[model samples]
Target: MAGFRPRVPAPADITMIAHHSVTLLFDLSDGADLAHDARGRYGRGSVAVGLLPGDFRASGRAGEVLQIRLEPVAAAALLGAPADLSGEAVPLEDVWGRDAAQAEDRLRAAGTWGERFTAARDILTRRLTELTRPDTRPPVDQEVAHAWRRTLGSRGRVRVGSLADEVGWSRKRLSARFSSQLGIAPKRAARLVRFDHAAHLLAAGRTAAGVATESGYVDQPHLHRDVKEFTGLTPAAVATAPWLAIDDLAWPASPPPAPMHQRP
Candidate 1:
């Protein structure tokens, strides 16, 4: 398989792991630092390639990045840890759990693609070893995630407050924990989830109006504002994206020019 490789300091530091698919990465070799900011409406802030909504912005590595194909939602679900690519060295515990230090060490020690790949796989496997087989009862956050998924499927919208209430957490407490673990706010996460739903509909050749309604936008104008704000482009621009092919190896792009809609 044609997997990507990570590097420490080189232009090729950030390489595409798969064709617009799940990204796998090899960290910096030895003591070299990796730097990059993953900024977008759909991706995690900064995290390992397997993390969902994670798009590689810029990184410094001399090694290789090994990657695989993964759907957006599946990628999001695998995010049981925290990731930060804000050009700041966020503590691992602040992002992941108490085990974050160990994971970071292992990742940093990984020098080659083989080493990093093995470490990543092992870390993920061991971390989620409890869920090797599905169970009726899961951790509270996981339960909350499930609930959010259900809400999205039914009403096509999710509010952080509702989820926090269900889990008996204050909004502040829940947001703090969620941001540390997921590298984004609960409300932003919900917005991305909603955007994902709309993206899928649009990709299926659905009209903007239809997609807006189905994905819970208040109206076409509202959808237009959302599409523009999330993506730097308009819906029409995205609709004609030339790289809109399956396995097309394209990053989601900004939309076309349109009048700015003020955020209420």
Candidate 2:
């Protein structure tokens, strides 16, 4: 979870790279708009952005935004739906209905960013609790969950075949189940995770060649191609991306633990 309020207006345009987690953006401004490839205009309010939305740009007046990134396992239960959000961004109202509006109202009513963050967390916690009650939905499979963790822990360098073998499932079965639950093939997820790590390294002043090797890319070109494919930007460009500049402030820690509402 992260809360952001710009002290000044936004820059010209900010290009975002694809990431491995589901993103929830709560708009707390009156005039700013969020636009993406799938949804041209995101009105003022809460918006749910799924994983791996390639190369989207956010352009409009600057404003306060509460951004939450959820792992797919927890996101599935919190969202009251399958984790098939890859390459998609939808209105929060579409997922949470009137509750979405209520949340926004509560956040708006809060006097401080701390208060707003608390309100948003409470709303999400309540929703997750309600959705997971009495078998309303199936939890993500243990094997699938393990695979996702392994991929992320390894910085996307894990071999899917080995993961499947470790989980006692065939490659085909693992791929199918992972895709069905997480909205992305296991192999593709690994690539995205790996690219995310490499992007951060590049941003931190690592040479492209070093980042490629350390991130498990075959070579610099392999890293470059993956960066381009996910972000529509070359490795050099991605190294200086403004979108990544705020990541440390927004998400300072490692991937968070599963929310209490999710099943073990």
Candidate 3:
């Protein structure tokens, strides 16, 4: 997928930050009145990127893009807040990193990975005391997100019983709490995490069969069905769908990650 032609903005140009992890993107694009169609909001352009968690759909009109990726745990630690995110895009300064203006200026000048990461680390160190609230409030479980993350990394599978056991909560309690906090059920969230992994593998050029086996799906067909359910496209279709494909390449494939436990 090299030599990807820079595309004109289609109606749904926004894509999700997949991979079942949190990430940071530095928006270097000019101030185009961009809308996060997923959240249904618009904002002025700036040198800030969001420290976002998994599957938070985002899109905007075309602009010069500058961004840095971060781990979910690292990102959540910096934000020090929880809940499903659906909010007005905020300046990078308000969250983790150095002074928003200074960082933006540095990125504009230095234009190097080192410079961008330095700014990212600065933000991670300086916690956001107030910008802790998600743009939208959905019942989501911090514990489940954390457990789901571990399950993915360890076994590439999510078992509800195991998650509840690890978090020291009953299955019913965990499901209820997860629903209340993330606005999704524990099982559903786990499915998204798995599906997210599948999406990543596909984007990375792993064949559907290999992804299915490695990601712990029963088979390729099962994986295909699940992917279609989570995202309306088949595995092959997702490969070219504007929203998902753009998302697949939105950031460096192997960006830094944060641990889930560090969030609370």
**Cα RMSD (angstroms) for every candidate in the order listed:** 10.1, 5.8, 8.4
47-101 per-residue lDDT for model 3 (tens digits)? 2233233234444553434444434444444443323331224544455445555
Q: How many backbone clashes does candidate 1 have?
A: 28
Worst 10 residues of 3 by lDDT: 255-264
lDDT of 1 at 28: 34
How well is each residue in 19-42 modelled by candidate 2, as lDDT tens digits?
Answer: 898888776666435443444544
TM-score of 1: 0.51
TM-score of each: 0.51, 0.86, 0.61
Better of 2 and 3 by lDDT: 2
- Top candidate when judged by TM-score against the true structure: 2
Model 1: per-residue lDDT, tens digit, 1-264?
A: 123332233444342211212343323334334454443322222234433333334445434323333333333444333233222222234434566556657766666546665776787667556443475333235644554455455443767777778778887887876665445566665666676567666766789999898888888887787667655567776565432322222323334212111110
